[model samples]
Target: MVEALLEARNVVKQYGTVRALQGTDFSAYAGTVTALIGDNGAGKSTLVKCLSGVAMPDGGEIFLDGQRILLDSPTSAQRLGIETVYQDLALAYDLDAAANLYLGRELRRPGLLGMLGVLDKAAMRNGGAGALANLGVRLPAADAPVGSLSGGQRQSIAVARAVAWASRVIFMDEPTAALGVVQRERVLEVIRRVRDSGVAVVLISHNMPEVLAVADRIEVLRLGRRVARFAAGDVDVEDLVGAMTGALEASALGANDVEANDVEAGAQTGGEGNTNGGNGR
Candidate 1:
């Protein structure tokens, strides 16, 4: 097996009395997608916070590329080539797609002023266009205002940025939640490209079909604790839902199942009446 690009062992976190995570063991391979599934408040967001360095874990360790390290802050995770695209997609609506693509990490020409210098707009445009093509995503234009683009295009920009910048792991939080049919497919296609390029992907999604379609493995987070792990081929969507909902036995499926349960369904996902199911995207 390939070495894990990111690994969390015995990880625990708390927000006063809430206790968001309880000693979770999670890992992702360099060229595969791992879906983190749960009903809600299953510590999915908290786990993402810890993994992305948004918050520090109260205990346990995180290892990247086999080296145990401390993620005291998001900057640390970024410095180590870990990046995340949140549900908002984090784009500047007023700006064009290319502009949002390089937000904060803008390309600049060699001039008297460093960051104060003018941006290399032509280069950025070309580079951003290339990145979209490289990921097999189709959009109207690279210069289109992000606000003017379709839901998929905006999501594509966020995903394209993560792919363009990351070297190891990319965490996507509900990437397809607010997109249309064609748009959602485009986003999923981009995800496959990310994995194909050999980057490990951690997807926090409520859409089980999306998870089953592309994930090589599924990890269930219930009430902030990882309750079960499933190989993509070994478990069906019903089983996954059962696992996520805390209605299945640890040994529901033989051999391939690793059982864990210190937490139950503390949260409900965006599917059903929840309505934010990015799975459609």
Candidate 2:
């Protein structure tokens, strides 16, 4: 309703003989968690790659703030305020939490030393500390090596890093996949905080309850296409499972159940499809 902060129009991707995506149109808005849910092999990973600049779609367009743009590389996407936290967390094990946060974008010392590429360890450490605090995430210490942190703590650092730098959108790919129940809840809270801070959060997950609990809107991807969209409040877990499996009929929930105008947009792009249970990831 606020106008899509990010949208993919008729996006397509392929892998040799496999058509990973069939003109999938996806959209996300500011200050909301838009869940991308599907069985494995639903092209969720492919779509994530495309949206995050890890891979280009074989065809289609991606728009940000109503302006069409190209995400040719990860840096390009980052420059455009798009950041992704993959399931892997991608942290530097040997480096401290603060160091991981400032991995490639470390702050520099003042004046000539700064010009000489001298690392500003103190500044980074303090900034990391503040950022974590701002996100309500408690860790052992910013100076603690990431490898020494718990799974939830590491995931928190990853989310905190993204939240600190993400100006527009953040893509979270199965962020709660490997966590314990408590850790999962912790990350979910961090995600809610990110959404509350006005960042467009795209959450990809297989856990229906978690998706329903945290997402503002849910987009069901079946095979390589989007089959349905649901307002988080309008549909229950049964409805989502039905939609994902094509058992409830595509667009069965109808657009009236949602507040956004584009709720039915995916129906126009969906078609015959197949997705391996949960094996695609």
Candidate 3:
């Protein structure tokens, strides 16, 4: 609430027939990791696409540090200092770590006669490696082809790419998805480093344990709508699942003020009826 670095409100997205996202509100402050979690089909992907500028929302407004702005394209988002690291990473497997790191923003060195026909390979190597380290990601070697690296290593490279160029908020989609235990931890460590470096991070993940471990706040979406939000320490996994499943409202978590209907439901359920009959049913 201390003036978010990035704030999105009432964002809506739709396909020709499918309304993938409904009105939604989300924000991430500087130096914090805001995790967005939900069950499958909870509009997580659609919301992420809108935030990343892959798909512009048909409704709602977005603000950067209290200033309303327009993001019509991916380049527009980048121009606003919002960088995104997708699950696939969009990296070229054929390239090495340094090459992959500088995929779009390649380093160039001036050649003789002012004809710069050379890629600054040395500079990229050193700078890329240092950036990776800054994000707490240690690659085996900067010269190693990205295709040869393990899933975790590749993820680390992808996250490092975002942090290295992002001057504001970084959106990470499943940063540790499919990674082995050690590799997952490594990716999480890098995410934490990014947060500590003062960049706001929006992490999209299905891994609740990982979310619980790294998130400073959690947002839950259900039926294509944002149903709840809570400070990390103020809520538990169960509360998040309740919001995602439509059993809880925003107040069920840490909301200070409860609406009339929300209060009535709370009275009947004792604020715990969201559970599934105490069984998996």
Candidate 4:
């Protein structure tokens, strides 16, 4: 089996009296779309934050390419080729597409101008346009402000920025949310292209059909811990819902049937006692 490009083992995170991640384990392979699914308050966001280095885990370990690593900040994660496209898109509404793409990491003019902090606008614009084109993203105009673009176009720009910088993995939180059908499909196509380019895409979304449609693997989280893992082709919406809601143990399908369907619903235990269902190999 291929070693996971990114892996989190027994991760734990707490906020005051609330425990956000309870020994949750996650893995994302290179060149695959792994969907992280759960209901609200299921710790999906908490885990993502930890994995993306926006937040630190209270305990447990994270590995990149089989070596343990510490992510002290978002910059640290980015330095190691990890990027996140948040649900908010986080693009500057007033900035044009190219500017937003290189918002924090702007290219500089050469020699004295670069030393004087003069940005190479033309270089940035050409680079951003090429990145978007490689992802098959279409914008109405190369110089248009991101705010002027459609929801999908904006989302695509955010994704393109992440993909342009991320050499290993990209965490996309609801890339298709609030988008029109055409826009959503366009974003999904970009996701497929990214995966095909050999970058691990960890997708977090509540839309079941969309998850099933794009995810190569699925991991279901409930009450701050992962309760099931499945190959996307091996499960349907019902199975995914059952796993997220803990209905797999109570539903008529029963344990044997779940096994038959190749679902590894975690042990019927609580808290840290719950184990990962199975590796979505």
lDDT of 3 at 250: 49
State the C-alpha lDDT per candidate: 0.79, 0.83, 0.77, 0.84
Tens digits of lDDT, candidate 2, 129-171: 9988876777866677889988778888888888888989999
Cα shift from native, residue 111, model 1 (Å): 3.5
Candidate 1 lDDT tens digits, 47-157:
888888888887777889889877778778888889999888878998997888788778897675545878888888889888878767677766778999877778878
Candidate 3 vs candidate 4: the lDDT winner is 4
In model 1, what is the error at residue 200, expressed in angstroms? 0.5
As for lDDT, the candidate ahead, 2 or 3, is 2
Model 1: lDDT to the true structure: 0.79
- Tell me how far candidate 2 lies from the true structure as C-alpha RMSD in angstroms: 5.1
Most accurate candidate by lDDT: 4
Off by over 4 Å in 4: 250-281
Error of 4 at 79 (Å): 0.8
Compared with the true structure, model 1 gives a TM-score of 0.85
Off by over 4 Å in 3: 111-117, 249-281
Can you rank all candidates by TM-score, best first? 2, 4, 1, 3
User: Sorted by lDDT, highest first, which candidate order results?
Assistant: 4, 2, 1, 3
TM-score of 4: 0.89
Put down candidate 3 lDDT per residue, 1-281, tens digits, no spaces.
37888887767676787767656667789999999998999888888888878887777777898988777777788888899999888889989988988887788886662255678888899999888887667777778889999877887788888888888889999988868887788778878877888889999998887898999988777767666666777767777777777676545444622222322222322222112112111
